[model samples]
Target: MLLKNPQILYALFLLIIPVIVHLFQLRKFKKEQFTNVKFLKKVQLQTRKSSKIKKWLTLLARLLGLACIIFAFAQPYLPETSQSLKKKETVIYLDNSFSMQQKGKNGELLKNAIQSLLTALPEDYHFSLLTNDEIYKNTTKQELAKELQQINYSSNSPNFKTTYIKAKKVFSKHKNTLKKFVAISDFQEQNLKDLEFDAQLENTLIQLQPEKNFNISIDSVFVKDKNIENTTVQVNLSSSTATDQLFTVSLFDHHKLLAKSSVNFDDNTKANTTFSIPTSQDIKGVLAINDNSLQYDNSLYFSLQQNEKINVASISDAKDNFLKKIFNQDEFNLITTQSNQINYNKLSHQNLIILNELKSIPQGLANILSKHLENGGSLSIIPAETINEASYNRLFNALNLSRYQKKQTEELKITNINFSNIVFENVFNKKVRNFDYPKVNSHYYLNTGANQILSYNNGQPFLKQIKQVFLFTAAINKENSNFKQSPLIVPTFYNIAKQSLQLPQLYYVNENNNTIEVKVKLDKDNVIKIKDSSKTFIPLQQHFANKVNLTLQNEPKSAGNYSVIANDKTINLLSFNYNRRESKLNYANLSSYKHIKTQDSITNFFSQEINDNQMNFFWKWFVIFALLFLVIEFLFLKFLK
Candidate 1:
């Protein structure tokens, strides 16, 4: 209990005046002689006793009523909290990630949370709001409501630790102040493991859970098979809960339906379907599934652009027949030139440069190869049997590759093949352990600092690659080694040349650090842009002589096919989709934390805050009590006598 104006309580001394008046009896009574002596004596005794009783009762009622009036004037109140000499700060962290599109009891998780916030905040109260992509500070309810209504799903994932630090920065730097942080989200466990709450701050973490946990998502889409006439596209699917349910997958080109298939997700929680399309045409494809649990991962976007031939430059001692057979004319522009007839200007435009059986490297050629690597071109080295080691060593040093050492005539069998490298992706149906082992005779004993793709029986690297450089320790000439006839020769050389171009994939995950190579010539000060039907923006790009390296950093806010435009022409097409990390719907258990208070609803938490900070006055109750005491005094005067 506390008083607003305690100085009014000094009127309590005025109650002593009423007591003195009651005791003095200032009006003296003149007694009249009674008719009979006995009757007068009896009547006088009874009157005196009744008079004393009335005086005492009236004195108590008057003193109590006067005291109640003084107390009412003092205006006492009940304190909800202790006396605060500090300022108050409130901050709200709202999650707008794609997973918040899940449905709860009311509607979508994000929509329901927004409605609760609208009802909880008062008209004049101000607070800071932090979302995945936007921030609003010291904003009123009206302003924040407008921003919330315009909010859309975000591709940026959530991290509670970063959010806590951001909330602290939003608060003013006052030493003596009360700060409260209210976080409302689905509380996915993806980024909550290392979050530590401040003990000095009041923290309320609310988890808006969905009604069900079962969800089906389109895991990925890729080109399973591609020939001259047709391309087979494979779609992978996954489920959160294990159930033998059949789901429908639809393939669309823009709005026209192309194909449909049914997938059965058994207890294994995986399924896949394939669709074949013409390999020659440009396709803006969309793969969609009917899943009501989460809407973001239910569809995938992809693009199939027209094929472009790869430029292969072979600088060899002579025209090798095997090299001619591998790089066909239909898909590869094979340019073969002798060492003396080399075109220095044509080297910069080639995608893959092969230093084929060079007897000795010139300083000029070594400088060119070094520049090619710096511009993101791939190089392969095939050394001669008896070559000038010093010249080749200088080339090796320039390219950061291992140099050939003293030549050995001993034989070593190619035993190990690393299947985990990205160069071997989708190259084999299954890992085959039994194959005709390839052997090399009279090979050089070289040292390397790279990933060993094919190793010898003695665990020595026969073929190793570091970044864009591939090295072979043995000579493939028929007189020296029969490795040219081995089954591993085709994939080993062909894929290395194929991987040199670094072409764009069917689709990329948005908001990730994804870099795609676009093979096009860029004029000076000219730029390319990625765009869809609604929005267009330039990506972070680096230009080489004949290609551009574009790094995506949150430009496409949706999942769809986009065009790569240069000089107002659509040179290439690409697609991007939101990451599927949130599809499993795994949530954190915030109740285990001691410093955090968990709330189920935003309205309930704010209601408790309002109640805790409110002041309840007792002045009205005191006024009512004073009136009651006055009524009791009147009752005594009217009926007790």
Candidate 2:
């Protein structure tokens, strides 16, 4: 028990007033002669005894009730058991991720949390505030209110491990002996997947902001195929509820409505809506879903570059008729040159290069080709019929490619093709059965550490690809093999060129990756800027030989199409959307934590603990006691007489 105002106890001396009144108001006695003196003496003794007993009872009741009233006025309460009054340093982590857009009965979860913190926290208690992407240290009440009002939701959704590490770093700088850690969030289940924390943190607190209604969100948007003129844009939608729902999906091109559709999902929980749009010109668009609860994830922004003509270059010892005929000048910009007459300077602009049956690879040529592959150009290696093994091995060693083994003359057929490879996507309208496979007359055996896309009947790889390099076991010509005449040759060569274009991703999110490589040569001193119609800012970037690595930090904040400008030239269009992790509204099971309070109860609990329950007034109880005791005194005066 503790007293709020011990000085009120001094009022106890007032009890003597009642005692003095009792003493002064006593009845006076006089001696008088009367008949029957013996009966008179007995009556006097009995009456005097009864009067003394009543007076004593009334005095006891008055003193007891008066003491209760005075003690209540002093404002006594039960203090928290622990009396550690060390000056405190409190750290509060407020989740301002996109998922906090969830609405409750009061308002949005983030807004409600700010209001609660402002109302509950005291002026004297200086604390640190941490959001997903920003931090404030030792903030005063005025500063806190200003910062809280400016705090808006962010696209970043940092996991609990990252948040915990950041909190630890911020709190470590403070030298206060008594420290308190408080985290307030919606506690989405994914946030805790990688949670790491010290179990023995002192005075730790967590305030979970729960959601009142369910939510549906647009999970992602991906460009299915960028090789074709008409590409499919697939939009993935998800819901928090177990039952199915109906949602409207809309596709917009620069704020112009391109396509709209309603999805009926009665038995399915997740559904995909795809739109076929032309990629003749650069396409910048947003795939949206009509979800009211969480609008941040309802739309996904994307951009796809226009399809340009592919440049194909072929270097061979002789003019191969099949290679020339396949790479027609009508559709492709083909550059055919003999090994001795090859132009090294023009190779940089070519999308795909075919190295035909060369007598030997020179060190200079090997170095140039290696640079081509590094610059995102695709290379195809076709072994020579009468090859110089030592010379080929030297070039192979220079490029870090696998050396070829002795040639095998066994007649072999390509038995398997990996249809699941992205290169084969949209190649076939229907599954093929009993299809004729291409045969190779002779091929060199190599232990190439690469992905085998086409394999032979004898378990040897006919074709293999690794990164930007491709390998063929044998040469393709009328004299060497009939593979050039096969149906697979046209699409295979076409896809090779398609894959080398270095297609930019439809959209990117900085959940785990913060950097993207753009294939554009720029002056070292030039600054690169990323901008939309509304905002523009310079991004941190690193220049490479033939590409630029741009680091996205607190950028592409909104979902939309953005232009990458260098020296005021619109070089490329880039798109970014909010991280899809926020779409998963599966919340954490707060009951699992031992020391946690819901948003509704945490404020009151903090007051009780910090203020020592002083607001718990008992004066009304004492007032009732004071009135009741006076009634007892009245009863004695009226009846006992």
Candidate 3:
């Protein structure tokens, strides 16, 4: 219990006046003769005793009534909180993340929370509005109401710790003595772990909006092998419940339906499905499931870029006939240059540079090739038959590749092939066995620290792959090694050139990683911009030697195909989708908060806080009691006499 105006309680001194009046007032004794002296004495004693009891009862009632009147004037109230200070600042965090899209009893959890805050918030306290993306301090009710109408779901989500830290900082700036924080969210348990509540925050309230229905979401979508004509897309799906159900999953390319499949989810939490689409050019795709309740995560978007021509630079003592036959002009722009007249500038544009049977590598050219390989370029080394070991080792040591040793005269047959390599992902239908493998004669012995793609019968590495560099220990001459005539030569070198163009990911999630690198060069005058059908904006970017790294600042708010444009040219296409963390549909236990109170309906909250509380005073009943006591006292004095 507490008093709003304790100074009015000084009127309680007036209660003593009633007791003094009762003590001072006394009936004067009148002596008179009676017919029966004994009967008169008995009657007089009974009357006096009854009179004293009535006077005391009336005096006690008057005193209590006056005290009640004084208490009413003081405006006493029951303390709802132990902290009696007036509320000055109220910070309200409204979770607008995609998880808030779940429907509650009222509607969507976010919208319901916003409406409740608008209607139930007290007008006395100044408010601060915080969301997943932005925070507004000292906001007016009208301004906040307007902002609430414009609020929508956000792809980014901040955990409770971050939100609480932000609120504590905002509260620290205020000079007010009393402060409070109210967080309105579905309170997903994952986002509410290990939160530190500041002691300065006197009052903290977490309003939990309960979700009614389970949700099914398309967790992710990606492309496995983009090289084939029929590209296979993998779609990962998740459900909130473990019940058995059938759902339709569909795929779309440029708004046209490409494939549709049905998935059966029985007692499983997650499932994955694959769909194939025949595409050759750069195309935009969307993967969707028939989950209507939570529409935000039901669909995902992705894109695939067209295959570009690979520029292959072949430097050798002479134009080797085997190399010319392997790198066809249609697929590869094979620039065969003699070792003496090799143009260094052409190395910058070439995806894969071949050192085909070089007698010796020049020091100046070796340094340039080292720099090229460092900047994500690929190199293939094939030693000459009459090789100078010292010159080759000098270049090999400088380029950080393994050095060639003395030549071995033994005839070695290539037997082992790495079947799981991406280079041979879809190349073979069944495993190769005792077929006629390629043979190498008089191959060089080399020190290697790389994975062996092809091995000889004696377990020596025939073909090795280092980081961005490939090496063949055996020379690819028709007489020395039959590798040039083997069937594996076409796909092995061709795929290496194709893979040199770093394939962009199928889609991006809007999280801490907001940067995406594209294989396109830019100048000072050129700018990297992202655009969709509806909107366009220039993103912050930095230029590397051959690629541009763009930082997406809260871009692609909705999922769809986006174009990465360099100046006026559309350099590449990108896909974006919402983060799937919110699809878990798990909620935090609100009862765990120390000083928290829970109420189901906003109406009940207002009824208890406003209509049935302090503002609706009980003072009128006390005033009536005071008047009734005075009336009873008057009746005892006037009518009884």
Backbone collision count in every prediction?
0, 0, 0
Worst 10 residues of 1 by lDDT: 78-87
Q: For each candidate in turn, give its C-alpha RMSD to the true structure in angstroms.
A: 6.8, 9.8, 9.3
lDDT ranking from best to worst? Answer: 1, 3, 2
lDDT (10s digit) by residue, model 1, range 51-113: 889888977987888888899899988767763224688899999988899999999999989
Model 1 segments beyond 4 Å from truth?
1-77, 82-88, 124-126, 161-179, 191-201, 242-246, 266-268, 318-330, 340-345, 362-364, 367-371, 393-467, 478-491, 591-594, 618-641
Ranking by TM-score: 1, 2, 3
Candidate 3 residue pairs that clash: none
Candidate 3 scores a C-alpha RMSD against the true structure in Å of 9.3
Task: Give candidate 2 misplaced runs (Cα > 4 Å).
Answer: 1-80, 172-179, 194-197, 202-211, 222-234, 242-246, 272-281, 317-345, 362-364, 370-378, 397-499, 510-527, 540-554, 593-600, 612-641
Superior candidate under lDDT, 1 versus 2: 1
The sequence of per-residue lDDT tens digits that candidate 3 reaches over residues 498-597 is 6665556778875545767677777778888889999988888777677666788777677778988886888888888887888888887777766555
Compared with the true structure, all predictions reach lDDT values of 0.85, 0.75, 0.77
Stretch of 10 with least lDDT, candidate 3 = 608-617
What is candidate 2's lDDT per residue for 1-641, written digit by digit as tens? Answer: 66778999999999899889888985687667889999999988888899888998889888878888898798876544444334566678888887888887677888888887788777766888889878899887676788888789988777777887788777655464555677888778878875545644553445445545567777777766654468787888777774555678988888888999777556666777788888675678887777778888777888867534567898888556766677766447788898888788998777788888887775578888888877667888888777888888887877787878889998888777767665666788875545788888899997744478778887778778767777888877667777777888877777777676644677877443567656577886887898999899888887755566787876766777899897779888888877777877777776666544444444764675456422445677778887898788778877886
lDDT score for residue 494 of model 2: 74
- Could you tell which candidate, 2 or 3, scores higher by TM-score? 2
